[model samples]
Target: MSQKPTSSENIVNQKYDRCLADLLVKTGVGFSIGVVASVIAFRRRAWPVAFTTGIGSGIAWADCDRLFNPTRGPGVRIVSQAQTPESK
Candidate 1:
């Protein structure tokens, strides 16, 4: 009952995957930097600096949730009518 995706769908999926992967990689780097900055700030006992750094770190980590979501990534617009029930 199920059929293979058309060439366009395959291309769209590939593009989405690539975009998602890039977003995750970039977000991970940002989060790593934030963590390092927070650690350095806390170690120096700079309360104000540490607080700001920790806040930035939390924001960075929060953004990771979007990077993990499928519909959030940039890619082709798949029309509903073209999608099979299984694919949808």
Candidate 2:
């Protein structure tokens, strides 16, 4: 029988899944935009423009992946603690 996964393992799995989803979304958007730009460039006879744009967009896509999928500890942190006024 397989042993149950520990809480830490579960958290890591969740982070991996979230990271994967983020990457997929970023990549999908980048590809769709690149395809449309290519079509337009072809119509306009601007092959060089399309090539440069594709390169720039690829860099942006990687940046998005890095921005959203942080490798640092489980991204949870308390921003503030509520405080109550002195008891009446």
Candidate 3:
């Protein structure tokens, strides 16, 4: 029988799944836009496809980084519970 995963493990798995989904969606959108832009604006050049794809991948990477390390992300703050005198 397989044991159930711990809370921390579940959280990690959820984050991973979310990251993967984000990457796929973002990259696919970028690729589609790139294809359109290549055909219309860039004279069917291959560079636009590559450049947009890279931009999409970079955005996904940043999002994943922020998700995995919330404290390290910009404008993020962690607040601890205030201790009362009675608890001290």
The models' CA-based lDDT, in order, is 0.60, 0.61, 0.90
lDDT of 2 by residue, 30-69 (tens): 5566667667756644564556556655765565555556
Better of 1 and 2 by TM-score: 2
Prediction 1 global C-alpha lDDT? 0.60
List TM-scores for all candidates, in order: 0.40, 0.45, 0.77
lDDT of 3 at 81: 68
Which lDDT tens digits does candidate 3 get at residues 1-88? 9987679988999999999999999898889899999999999999999988889989998999999987988787776666434564
Predicted structure 1, TM vs. truth: 0.40
lDDT of 2: 0.61
Best by TM-score: 3
Error of 2 at 88 (Å): 36
Record all residue pairs in model 1 with backbone atoms less than 3 Å apart, i.e. clashing.
Answer: none
| Per-residue accuracy of model 1 over 1-88 as CA lDDT, tens digit each | 9997679777768766766665566556665665666577556444545455556556555555454465664683556765756654
Rank all candidate structures by their TM-score, best first, as comma-separated numbers.
3, 2, 1
Per-candidate clash tally: 0, 0, 0
Better of 2 and 3 by lDDT: 3
